[model samples]
Each structure stands twice: as structure tokens, then as C-alpha cells.
Target: MAVRPPQQDGDEPDTLEFGIAALSPHLSKSDLTFPATTDEVVRELGDPAIPYDANGNTVRLSEALGAVRATQFDTQRELLDALHPVLEEYRESGGGILSQLRALLPF
Candidate 1:
């Protein structure tokens, strides 16, 4: 993912990367079908890599889904909302200062 920070004066933001890892079988949120069961999503995604921090620590998509209580996602936004906290915790667990600092910045 290419994360772009908010720009000064409403200008376009600049994209920054910290040695990010690519998701295997790479698919974006838009590519997913909504109201998907956890098993359904996992089977389609096949445990793609999900980077948690700047250092490239990762958790598979299936593992992330397992960390959550929701068994079905009704929308792409719902999936992201449910996973955000889990992802954040994973990031901060190994993140130290950098990830914490990154959390304060705009996306």
C-alpha cells in the first residue's frame, strides 16, 4: 500500500513508503465481495501478507480475521473497520516508537 500523508495548504499529499511488503495474490478492498463470510474471504485471499509496521513485520489475512470476533463482513468498510484495531495492536506490539508516531499522522 502507498500511504500518502495529508498535504500542507490542501495540496496533494506525498506518498511515503517504509520498505513495505507486497501482499501475495495482491487484491485491494474493492476487489472483495461484500457480506463475505470469514471462511469465504480467507479462501479467496489465501493468507495474503499484511505488513504491520515499518520494519516489515507481518500477519497473514487469515490470522487477522481470526483475531477478530466478526464472522461476516457486510461491506468493505466494515472489514477495514474491524481489522484496523487488530492491525494497530499488531503494529504497536513490535512498533516501538515509529509505529506509535505514525499512528498520530494523517493517512
Candidate 2:
């Protein structure tokens, strides 16, 4: 059965599909803690590890002048920063992923 929105007296029920950002009006969305510079990203990401090569070896990427890279991929902040733009794009396209993601954001 199709779900129905809550109704008010003499008023039309809100039926517009809102993206995660819109739905999460109470959520704290900020990038104040994110890496602003690519250097910061690389530093935060840390050195890459090699399988079965635990000699404190660090992987280096070719200089891309202005790129963000970080070894802290497991952190919620990093993940959020990386996915925020993509989520925003989806949200703009009226895709459902943004809403789903918004519900799970600030992880």
C-alpha cells in the first residue's frame, strides 16, 4: 500500500520528496574539521601499507599539485568529506541515495 503523509485540518499533506540534506534540518553539517589542503589530505591519509610487507613501507603518489588524499579512509570525517559532493549531486538530481545517506551521515 502506498504510504500517506500526516495530514492537517484544511491543509494539503506535504508530499514533496526531500533530499537527505533537507530532511536533516537538525543534523550538524560542517566541514570545519575536514582537510582544506591536499597536503593535509595526504598527511591525514598516511602512508599506504603493503600486504605481507610490513617493513613500515610507505607508498607515494605522483605529485598532482592540487589533490586531496588521506590515509584515514576509515574515519567518518574522511568518508563524509569524500562523499559529500557526490551525495549533493545525487540530491540535486532528485536521487534517493542522498536521503538514505543523509539519514546515515555524521557517521
Candidate 3:
């Protein structure tokens, strides 16, 4: 379950804010807060332990740039290969929630 931070009224800017920034143009003034630090932000959201290095130093999300590194593996290809048979099975079963979800995928 994703836990959102408590909302504050007109506490800070959009870019620097967390929950509000994520919800963006859709968020109301009542749904905002002034998070003093990244720790505060993380605590409010009930996130799991922040990623860290082998040295036990806390790793900031911005600093962990390599986390998004692309690999030789093709994610789309892997997903399609794994899901095709399950989708086929759902179709043969006269369709259900899995079939509906499969239909919604851009693939």
C-alpha cells in the first residue's frame, strides 16, 4: 500500500514538494505541506528504508542516479513473453479481470 503524507495548506512550492508534486495540477491547496527535510518526507510517506551503500551511508534518491540505468534485457519483450500464454488462457476461459487488464496494456 502506498502511504501519502499528511496534507498542509500552502506550505511549499510544487517542484520541491512530494505528494503534492506527484499529484501536481490535480492537487488542491488543502493537500500540501512544508517538509523541512528529505527524512521528514520519507517518514511521512512510510517508505521502506531508503537505499543505502555498502558503507551504511544513506543514499539520496537523486544521488542514486544509476538506479534507472538501462540494461541489455528488453523489459517489454520479457513481459510479453511471460504474459502471452496467460492472456491466451483467459481468452479461452471466456474472459475475466486478467483479460480486461491485458486489453488495457499498450502492448
Candidate 2 global lDDT = 0.35
Ranking by TM-score: 1, 2, 3
Q: Count the backbone clashes (under 3 Å) in each candidate.
A: 0, 4, 1
Which of the two, 1 or 2, has more TM-score? 1
Alpha-carbon local distance difference test for all models? 0.67, 0.35, 0.32
Report how far residue 80 has shifted in candidate 3, in Å. Answer: 0.5
Q: Which tens-of-lDDT digit does each residue in 18-50 have in candidate 3?
A: 211222232132232442233332334443222
lDDT digits (tens) for residues 1-100 of candidate 2: 0124466665754443232222222123333234244445335444222111111111132122122344334444554455445434443443345445
* TM-scores, each model vs. reference: 0.62, 0.25, 0.21
lDDT of 1 by residue, 16-100 (tens): 3321223422546435687898888778777676876645556778888898899999976677778777877876576456656
Candidate 2 error regions (>4 Å): 1-74, 96-107
Model 3 compared with the native: what TM-score?
A: 0.21
TM-score of candidate 1 relative to the true fold: 0.62
Which candidate wins on TM-score? 1
lDDT value, residue 33 of candidate 2? 39
Residue 19 CA error for candidate 2 (Å)?
7.0
* lDDT assessment of candidate 1: 0.67
